[model samples]
Target chain A: MTIFNRLNPGNTANAAPNPQGRQTMPDNTANQATAPESKRPQAVAQPLYAAAGTGGPMTSVISKALKITGQLESTENIQVDGQIEGDVRGLSVKVGNGARVKGTVYGDEVELAGTVDGKIEAKKVVLTGTARMQGDVIHQDIRIESGAYIDGHCKPDFGKGGKASQPSLKAVAGEKTSAA
Target chain B: MPHVTHLCIIPFGVRRGLSLESETPFMFTLARTVNGKPAFARGADQDVSHLGPGLTATGLFETDGELYVYGAISGRVDAARLIIAPGGVVDGDVVAQDVRIAGRFSGRIFAPHVTIDETGNVKGRVFHTTVTVAHGARIDGRMPWRPQSYFETLKELPETYA
Candidate 1:
């Protein structure tokens, strides 16, 4: 079947073609990672928009046994193996497997492989094998591995009243819905 | 690594601009050196060419191109643009006046301007006058330093340019 070029507002020059043997340009490496977060490829005609190469979160690794007294602000990736007594602002953050954080985390993706004693506001949160948390969680997606401990409220970011954005829940670690 | 002394030129076809569609895998084989340099064997029945600065080529499909491991490539690629397609691997540093990356690239990259697409994964360091990275594309390195200008590219022209 031929897909006639429709003069619509949401058509793209690089639209997916049919099974016809027409040669297609290779997928531009530019449209890889973060592009899926925003404007994904949909069958329905919505305003086609995607933000690429915006230089994702700035990251830093805190190794020694120091402390952050004030607000820890960043726009990159960060790995913490020390102690913090403040708030964190960035993208994905990981508490090292041998560190402790005593503050609130505000970011997109937060992975805790160590210990946290505060609150968290993230889109995707992961608790690895060696993680221990005693705080509240507000997240869209979460992954808790075996042998992890948590001592606070785990509120699913269900948009409103448990109605999540996705039709079906994306079970990460083989289990569907459980707050533990 | 031995410093590149010279660059060889080969012609395949002439076009104003070329874009490699993803349907077919792009290949560039360096058959022989224009300067009679010894060619190292990377694979059997492979095209061979030395990658370096101040080099130019006319028209050659990227059936196979030299992969620079820890060296630098500073030159003007006219009519022939090295297209690193999706999953395409460039093992060394790449320095070009005009470049477009749409695959996986390792080592350092130096260009006046670079466009890294989503499927593009770059590791190592980079230096450019201008840079642009599309979403989903990844750069696992730092912006190190810039290369020579297009004017300096002409400095080697006393033998080839002038």
Candidate 2:
């Protein structure tokens, strides 16, 4: 529970605790064209922790047809093969080849293979081939491959005075250190 | 079926990073139905977008292909075919052609065809033309019925609800 000090995914469920008590859903088969896929929830760790915002290390994919005009904030990995017009904050953000972004990107690790028209603030940054950047990049570690075009300076001050890394991530890190 | 080629283009669309238009190779595949018609008996290649369990996203997402959510997303999602795998959680409004949920969803949904699996925990409203709710699914809201035409003309979602 302490792992997600900022982003809590269980708040809604806890707020409405079992409103449908013993009320069985009707057996309606007319609308069911396909049978249920076998995707049972695994009996893993505590549901509270495992189902929290601090997901394991899985990645999220953003398809090409999708476009986001608002801010995208996540506590996990994100792969973007789409177009984004706002800020993106994630753990590890990967801008796929030919994708387009028009705002800042914040993450612990960020890899860009697309076109970015704004800034990037991260601990580690990688710009692969086919990347076209038009703004500055603030990172602690950076790698730029050949064929990547950049039109701005690369600053090595990520958490100095710029956008601070997510506090929830710090808490996660703190827990990992204490556990180790 | 003739639609198998369209189904194959879902993953190819993701790989090509093509813009939203008819120029992409994925568009020709969706020629049969484009106007929010609920997906039915689609090909086995129903998974194109995957959000793994360790990810969380907030904002609006729009797509014309298949999507699988095993993570957490809070916002608006518009897609053709969507599957919320077990352990996934979505808290927002969704306008999907075909939606299948095996996880937890708390919000308003407008779709032509909807499926709620046994492990699903849903709270709020579901506007559908055809819906199937499996046993052991927990619902704490309303499942309002709507005509297929209602979804076909749903090009512009009302900003009041979502």
Candidate 3:
């Protein structure tokens, strides 16, 4: 990339196309570059491109100004900048700053930079500094950045199937075995 | 064939109007030039919602910036500017300042500036101040023209008999 390309933000030309260069982009910068610049994620990219929809390949965006009052589910990634009053299920869910969600968020990876009044269930969960989580976080791996507010519990029991999720069932099974 | 011609008989903004069907040359240019500025530039940084392909969202989506849907939404959408990309589908009412549709919309649209692309398919009423429909666009509803000032105060849509 030339010096002019360095100054101009529009240049996504892979002059130095390496895995390391994409990781250098900031979190917010990834959103900007998604549509106009490039479709590369700023960090570790997941291998779910084909799940983004084969018929029409586009990102389902919930713009910052939009407010939804019901459920949202997507096979592809969802970037939310608006307010949602219902649950959101997607492959990757990004809740932006100033955004508010009153329902649960279910995804493979969930990143919260806003206020979520409901629970978050994902394989990987990231709570940014501006995140305000008022409910539980059930995840296998979790990263809570500094300044993130949490008013609920954090459980690291996720994706272990029903055994990890069903404590009450285990108690019932134990009683049956003991009686026998 | 002209049962819908009654939609254009409002006579509210008849005196200060441009011919609706005969202005073919102007229909293609209005969406590109608004106060000598690119219409897409208005979407810069403000629009944050982009629904990519194959996704289906069913809810009430309200936004101040543009909402670009490449997949589908089966609920109400209220935005400042809404762009439905090619193959996108919206199955409910939409209220916006400016709406550019290249996809399929099947509900009432309340907007000031409405542009329908060639690949667009519309199936409901469109209340617009300035509308431009490209050729080959399939429209199955009425396009009732309104004055620009009416849209400025268009807080709610008026009830229709249908």
Candidate 4:
């Protein structure tokens, strides 16, 4: 049986340091700190593939000013930079700065740093830095940066006693999963 | 099919003709066709719950919110739905309540409702209760093959009457 595994951050590739100046883990582990780059996770020779079914926690990054007219589903991570005109379904989605999207996003965790013109569904949503949104935001936890521009309703109902804080993207990032 | 219970089928040698056992969430069943026949089936008492070939199953086929089928897969499914993306290939039939195909598929597919997109290329037979085919989509399969319903039989008369 031939098993093919994904090449992680520090694996065999032309992966330089993340532009955000974040340091990757010396070993393979999800809890390792990460740096950012020009737009998306910059691993030149690496292929972009994730586990199926965004029904879990997934992420995707739409770099550049591209456009997609279909549903984006991933189970672990999602990041959008270009433009999406459909539903974004995943566990977590991060819209980078200068990104423009016109679609509905549903997930357990979401972060926006650009412009969105649709509904946002997640357990928690954080709008930081250069975010400008115009839609409904439903989540159990929310943090909007002082400079963030949002023109929509916000709801943080994770049930009584914060029962709605089940799948936290922050937790996923902090807790260090098995994936590196 | 109300008596339908969740089943887990793993082949001993990845061979077909193995019966799947109902009542287990940890065991994932991958049906493959070898030499034009079911070839592999095994059973594991432990939870395949969090492991698959390489992919992850988020409540798509298992109970613990994970179903892993480490490689390419084909067969019948009815639960969290199966999505065949572009460049993904599946052989044989797929039966589910809802299906989204963006790849290449051959053989028969039975679903209560089916959606084939422009990138979908389906040949062989289809037995959907209701179907939606988009433009640029390719489907060379028969539609509306429910014989147990009287209304469906009436709907079938139009083709015969014409």
lDDT of 4 by residue, B1-162 (tens): 221342334444432322243212111232222112221221232112222222221211212111222223444232224455554555554544345565667766655556675667888766665677765778776665553232212211122211
Best by TM-score: 2
lDDT ranking, high to low:
3, 2, 4, 1
Q: lDDT tens digits, residues B1-162, model 3?
A: 111111112133431253352222122122222222233334556455677775777767755456777778887786666888777899988877778887899989887789887678999999898898876789998998877666655544566636
**Where does candidate 4 stray beyond 4 Å?**
A1-59, A158-180, B1-162
Query: Against the unseen true structure, what C-alpha lDDT does each candidate score?
Result: 0.47, 0.69, 0.69, 0.49
Question: Which runs in model 3 stand beyond 4 Å of their true positions?
Answer: A1-58, A161-180, B1-44
True contacts kept of each: 0.00, 0.49, 0.79, 0.00
- Report the lDDT tens digits of candidate 1 across residue range B1-162: 121333333243411122143111111111223113222222332221222111111111121222211112222222113445443355554444334565567755545556676666887665566677776778897864444453124212222111
Q: Please write out the lDDT profile of model 1 over residues A3-87, one tens digit for every residue.
A: 5443221334534453334223223323443356455423211211111222333235444222233344445666666555556
| TM-score against truth, every candidate | 0.31, 0.65, 0.63, 0.35
Q: Say which prediction, candidate 1 or candidate 4, comes out ahead on TM-score.
A: 4
Cα lDDT of model 4 by residue, A55-144, tens digit: 433233343323344344556566665555556666677787866667667677788998889878788789997899898787878998
Query: Chain B, TM-score, each prediction?
Result: 0.45, 0.70, 0.70, 0.47
Better of 1 and 3 by lDDT: 3
The model with the greater lDDT, 3 or 4, is 3
DockQ score of each predicted structure, in the order shown:
0.02, 0.25, 0.33, 0.02
User: How many Å off is the CA of A39 in candidate 1?
Assistant: 49
By DockQ, the best candidate is 3
Tens-digit lDDT track of model 2 for A12-120: 4333443454111211221232233333333221342243345357677776656655566667788888777767778899998968888788899999999999888
